[model samples]
Target: MIRLVTLQSGIAQGLLWAILTIGVYITYRILDFADLTIEGTFPLGAAVTVVLINSGMNPFLATAVAMLAGPLAGLSTGILNTVFKIPGILSGILSMIALYSVNIRIMSDKATVAIAGNSIKKIVATLFPAGTVSNTLSTTVGIIVCAALIATLYWFFGTETGCAIRATGNNSKMSRSMGINTDMMTIIGLMLSNAIVALSGSLIAQFDYGSALVNMGQGTIVIGLASVIIGEVILIHKEHNFAYRLFSVVFGAIVYRTIISVVLTISGFKATDIKIITAIIVAIALSIPVFKEKAAMRKKRNLAMKEGK
Candidate 1:
């Protein structure tokens, strides 16, 4: 019974974290750049939302405001990367380092701030009520929000500018030759990616943890990359469909969470072993493609030898 509950909780957590993974996908996969600002943006969104809510702002409006907070951070990275010619990863690191102090200020210089007041703390808490299984509501909300974002992204990415952004990621030089402004595309992509990432921070802070902690986003990049890699492994053949890829990312998070939950429940692995588990999962998932390619090459060599014989 406890295992069942744990599994259910894992699924819920996966659903929530999937938003962050999708956000990571925009820059990591879509734009083909590294942006570490998400580590700060995640908790930044949370801090902004919680502070605003505690100050008597409407939860919905406060959350919306938090969503906007991410793009500014992205914009900073964009300017640093595109204008100053700093590397993408370094630009992101600078923004992330700066956001740490910003987030601390937003949280009123506190380490953590708990959700307060009579307003709905969790986004879907009203639907679940106090005593019901929290996982069900979380799953439902996750499905709704993720599906909506995916659908919206599908339509947006099919447009001319979206195609240009995708092209820029594919080959910036070719995109430049084709008269697309690669720098602007990178900026837009970074902005869009961080926007989604910040929203995830807001939602996760409000929906799951019920508090905004300074270190909530610690090592988030690994988890996001892990989820993306896991999803790609399972849906390796669906690379052509953007929507399908996004769905895979969402599913990957769930699978990642489920694996962790199962291991902790059945094995002697403590909760603290999660980071190592994540690292192992990511490493194994990453090697799958290499392994496949080697196997294919060996098979081809064998066939060639047979023919020669």
Candidate 2:
């Protein structure tokens, strides 16, 4: 029974975090840039939402503000990379490091900030008022929100500007030659990506943890990469359409969280080992394609040897 509850909770959390993974995919996969600002923006969003909620703002509005703040972080990284000519990875690292202090300030110099008002789940329960299960409501909300986000992204990416962004990622030199401002595209992509990430963080802080902590986003990059890689592995042979790939990332997040929940239920799993386990999972997922290619080459070699004999 406890395990069942744990699994359900994991699914709910996974759905929320999938938003962040999708955001990561925008920067890492689509933009071909490793922007580590997500680690900072995640906690920054949580801090902003929690502080606003504690100050009597509407929960939904607070979440929106949190998302709005995300773009600023991304913009900073973009400026550092484009204007100052810093390397992509370094720019992200600088932005992430700076956000630590910013997040602490946002939380009023506290390591954590507890929310004071009703959570979204409770608010939904109030609207229903008919023995609405909090877990089920939360999960339902997560699904609806994720689906809406994915649909919106699909539409946006099909636009002219979106195609230019895609072209910038595929070949920056060619995009520039074709009159696409690669720098502007990078900034826009990063802003959009971090906005989604922060939105996820806000939801997580409000619905799951009930507080925003400074260290809440620790090791987030690994988890996001793991989710993306896991999804790609599962969809290795699927059509490379945008909508399908987005859905695959969400599914990957669910699977990753499910695996973690199951591991935690085992007898000898220590809480501190979670990061190590996540690392192993990500490593294995990333190596799958390489292993497959190597196997294929070996098989080809064997067939050639047999023919020669």
Candidate 3:
């Protein structure tokens, strides 16, 4: 039997991870590049949000600003890769390292902040009219806002600029040959991806009992990639529609979180094992195409043998 509370928590965690999955989607899927900077930027956003909220800023506004910071982080990585001619992987690594100091600064020079005192929930309570209705209203507001943002992203990806971005990812050489500035597209795509990641981190800091630590973003990229892969595994057939494919990342993120929740609920599973499990899952997902190819050949050979008989 499934626990309702655990199920809801898993869904919330999944939604949070969706933001990271989208970020990875931009670099891994869209740009056809590997970017490690996401791991740092996620924590940076959370740190920034925590600091601002503790200082009496509006939690929602703080989270929004935090999201905006993600693009700037991505832009730095893009510049390193494109302008300096650094390898995509190396550029992402350099940017991720540099962001550690920036994240610390964002946290007001603290390694972590305790949010038990000044929290988004407290702010919501004060802002809304007193009673149980207020709590429901706040939760509803957050969910609606997040859902709207996701929907808007879906629509935006269908626009002309978005198409250019996708083209840059699908075929950089061809895109350049057709007069598209592939470099510009790369920068823009990373910016958009990281921005969503930051937004997710900011919201998570608020929702997951407040507070943010310097290492909060560790393993973020892996989690995002796992979500993308898990979603693909579930909706293996929707590869044709770009919109649906993008949305699949979100669903995958949720599913990934749900699985983790179930595992944790079962006794004796160490939470730290999550990273190990995620890596294995991604590896298995990556092998799917290869396995399918081998299976197809075997099937073809069996059919030929039957024909000969």
Candidate 4:
């Protein structure tokens, strides 16, 4: 049944993944690297957070610890790429493969770790003391985290270091010529990206999934890329502002999840078909610019023909 609850859950899930999209945006867009490490980083965050929560650590502190753990993976990728002279994509891939084992270790060699009983204090619980695992509570937690993330990112990107990172992404050679340590910028950007990816995983474990599964983050990189592409399509004037683009990415994630939810409800789409749907969505979104260019060319051709006639 396509109930209101379903829509709310979709929105909430979108919000959580929006954080992941932002993390991906930093590495893919800002650092100009396809960081596959994020695929493993997400689940690592969830596994670490869940384990800490089960061990009776404060949820906020547990989340922080998990967030910090993300940078270690990023650092490994960075070292491989920068120091060992590995290609960016291959370095990220190697780190991601290694993280699967690391995530397993974090989960105590378990495939899944469930957050335990009433003794656990998660962020959503702290936000709504009286409420059960309702859509409203989940949505609130998502909103709070998303808002804080956006504001912090916006401010950070305006700083000198952030500008250097962007410059590195835009033109590494030019940035190097300009006396910026492009290598450091790339490492910092990756670290920042994976940190947020980890944060999203932690919140998902606590707020949405209520359990940490090793394979839960599979195919997440594509989802993040699709979300970013959808946002670019929605915002026609993407050059106007950085903040707007970030906001659009969040909107894109929500819209994509809502569409999926509706499809699942109305068409009886299998849960396993989600990857196929995501692939279709990305293909369509990516083709929009080419379609627009073709239309403009056709219009100009007709106008030129009429003037010649």
Give the candidate order by descending lDDT. 2, 1, 4, 3
Residue pairs of candidate 4 with colliding backbone atoms: none
lDDT per model vs. reference: 0.88, 0.90, 0.80, 0.87
TM-score of each prediction: 0.93, 0.95, 0.89, 0.93
For candidate 2, the TM-score is 0.95
Tens-digit per-residue lDDT, 1-309, candidate 2:
347788787788889889999999999999999899999999999999999988988888888999999999999999999899999999999999999999999999899898888666667777776886556766877898889889999998999999999999999999999999999999999999999999989988877888999998888889999998898888757568899999999988888888888888888999888899999999898888799999999999999999999
* Candidate 1 collision pairs: none
Better of 2 and 3 by TM-score: 2
CA-only RMSD, every prediction? 2.1, 1.7, 2.8, 2.1
**Tens-digit per-residue lDDT, 133-238, candidate 1:** 6688778878888999899999988999999999999999999999999999999998888888888888787778888999998889889999999988887674
In candidate 1, position 11 carries an lDDT of 85
lDDT of 2: 0.90
Quick one: RMSD of model 4? Answer: 2.1
Clashing residue pairs, backbone N/CA/C < 3 A, model 2 = none
Runs with alpha carbons beyond 4 Å of true place in candidate 4: 1-3, 117-123, 126-133, 236-238, 304-309
Off by over 4 Å in 3: 116-146, 238-240, 307-309
Q: Count the backbone clashes (under 3 Å) in each candidate.
A: 0, 0, 0, 0
